[model samples]
Target: MDAPDTAPGTPQAESLEVLYQSPGLPRWRLPPALAALYGSDLGFTEPCLYANFVASLDGVVALGPEYRHSGSTISGREPADRFTMGLLRACADAVVIGAGTLRASPRHHWTPQHVHPSGAADFAELRRRRGRAADPELVVVTARGALPADHPALQTGALVITTATVAAHLRSSLPASCTILAAGQGPALSMREVLDAVHNRGHRVLLTEGGPYLVGQFIAGGLLDELFLTTAPVLAGRIDAARPGLIAGQEFLPALRHPASLASVRRHASYLFLRYQFHRSITDASDILP
Candidate 1:
């Protein structure tokens, strides 16, 4: 090339900033109607759900026995990951997960039993300001159909998703209050089928808070649409073998498929938070995530 056009004396910060950005990553934002589907609870008629999770720098989504339960002090909370999850549920038709996940992180029901939930009490006013609704359906997806209906989470009436095989394996005395949707010939319901079922229910905007296996299944099956991953400044570690947390051997960016393009980043405490849309052929594909 010829002599450099911009030198130390030149201000090419804007030009150089563009180079650091990824190809499929969203650079210019979508108008409110398009990309705003996540934050706003109303726009989605069947908009794929928002699945949020936080991990240490090592990408360890979970640690110890509690799944995604890294002391609420991590990126997820301190910033209200619990409430964020609750709000997501508040707007969801269902919350989804796998059989193994239920045995792992396992939500014992934190929301109130009333289905309408008293109109968000505090969050309803805030949601109205953002042009989204404060109401949603609550559900749980598991393979074993083991979440006791008497548990606080399910006691409130969130439906449960599982498989025919798993249901057969479930405790015979399982509570009748639990609405279980049995899946294919196998114990685990295919992710695709679950999404379709939720769509029919009118969640429109779904949110999936996950354990590692569920996250892996979504990525491997290519259904991940938008990812909200929070990276804490520390590492979970490499010595432990069994409790390796979410996506241990799983891939975050599959080379063969479309890349996970960055949508935005925010800072919390000492952590870095990012939102990325699954860039490429699968943003709204029904089989994956429409």
Candidate 2:
């Protein structure tokens, strides 16, 4: 599919068409002015975790060997997608990403303004109104403490969640501005422990921009509450072994399938934005049967 015109000022002022929305779900649409979309309407009373990703029409999240940042290949740096990512970051108290994701985007700063510069002022206003920090705290999960220490995001100071062994290893390597949270005793970090640590810091709205494997851990632990997925019209046919789908390195058995309810859908030219809310009972790990 051909990409829509992404001229400097046109996309930020265009409204996305709402082709279909689930019944009783919010009827919100992306405003032309890039004003806060669904501002403060989420009503998240406690720590709620949500993830966002862009994938090809055939469900491939990454294009192997072609792009360093897989998401860029899928979305092709679409303006609407960037705006939506910014809006989600504006609503979040923290933006969680894996060490691999941080390594992929060397220049990315997990802030709303960084992705959507046109809506910088609006994003700041939203944060101010919500009484959030100047920028969402960057939460980087790494079990082995292996990270790109010189990356820009790390230089900006982030919360590195990892195992105790990794924390000790990172103490002398990571930037002084970075803080470490030992979420596990050994090599593996538990998703539940990471969420507890995040919640302890008073972050109620958490947003994750994952690199598939990390997302798989959240799914396995039943910690993912919602997902915001952008389906680009193009097909990225992947025959390589390295390419991955939305969820990787994990599989749900037939009896353990976790179904998600369609929350909303919006269209921008040929692209489709989808919001899916997973069943609460299934997402709570304690409620799941072995």
List TM-scores for all candidates, in order: 0.66, 0.88
Alpha carbon lDDT of each predicted model: 0.48, 0.75
Candidate 2 residue lDDT tens string, 114-162: 7777888877877777788889999998886779889888998999988
CA lDDT, candidate 2, residue 82 = 81
**Residue pair clashes in candidate 2:** none
lDDT of 1 at 160: 67
lDDT by residue for model 1 (44-66), tens: 22366556776677666655553
**What's the lDDT for residue 65 in model 1?**
54
Best by TM-score: 2
Error of 1 at 66 (Å): 6.6
